[model samples]
Target: MSQLNRVAWIVTVGSCLVAALILVLSGYTGYAGVTLAVAIAAAINLF
Candidate 1:
């Protein structure tokens, strides 16, 4: 269960970062910032 939780958070962080990257590439800085914030939060939860 712990391992699964870790995996879920990792995937959440990874996907959020990827989405932020795509958003930045498309010039959506505001949305990208939000996604990046979410990624950071997920990373914090990870540890």
Candidate 2:
């Protein structure tokens, strides 16, 4: 993979981890939003 792709994956994983942590602390209410946001971010990096 290219350097940019590597960086993007790192950011995506980091954000997902952060989101998971937030969901854990805040409960399921945040789960859907965080998951959706992470999915969109990851999807964008695919192109």
Candidate 3:
């Protein structure tokens, strides 16, 4: 299940980035920033 775990992490990072983008478009900079941080953390897990 290693492959599945990697895929899950990738999806998590991708979705977080997308959510951050949406938040930014809707004027939720604070929340967007938090989302970005989470995305960064997820990306780190990719390594």
Candidate 4:
């Protein structure tokens, strides 16, 4: 992949990780955390 694509993927993954961490730390668990993380990452990418 191109450098720009790689950077985008990195940002997406980083956003997902941060989202998941926030959810977990805020008392969300398991599927809820993963779903919220994916949703947050998808929203970020969409924008």
* TM of each candidate vs. truth: 0.94, 0.58, 0.94, 0.64
Q: Kindly list the per-residue Cα lDDT of model 2 for residues 4-42, writing each as its tens digit.
A: 897887788677767777777777756857675776777
Q: Score each candidate by Cα lDDT.
A: 0.96, 0.72, 0.96, 0.69
As for lDDT, the candidate ahead, 2 or 3, is 3
Model 3 pairs in collision: none
The TM-score, computed over Cα atoms with residue i paired to residue i, of candidate 1 is: 0.94
Whichever of 3 and 4 has more TM-score, that candidate is 3
Q: Which of candidates 2 and 4 is the stronger one according to lDDT?
A: 2
In candidate 1, which residue pairs get closer than 3 Å at backbone N, Cα or C atoms, i.e. clash?
A: none
Write candidate 4's Cα lDDT for 5-44 as tens digits: 7677667777777777777787788855776667666556
Q: Which residue segments of model 4 deviate by more than 4 Å?
A: 31-47
After superposition, candidate 2 runs with Cα above 4 Å error: 29-47
**Cα deviation of 30, candidate 1, in Å:** 0.8
Give, for candidate 1, the lowest lDDT window spanning 10 residues.
38-47
Error of 4 at 41 (Å): 11
Tell me the tens digit of each residue's lDDT in model 1 across 1-47.
49999999999999999999999999999999999999999899888
lDDT of 3 by residue, 1-47 (tens): 49999999999999999999999999999999999999999888888
Candidate 1 vs candidate 2: the lDDT winner is: 1
Off by over 4 Å in 1: none
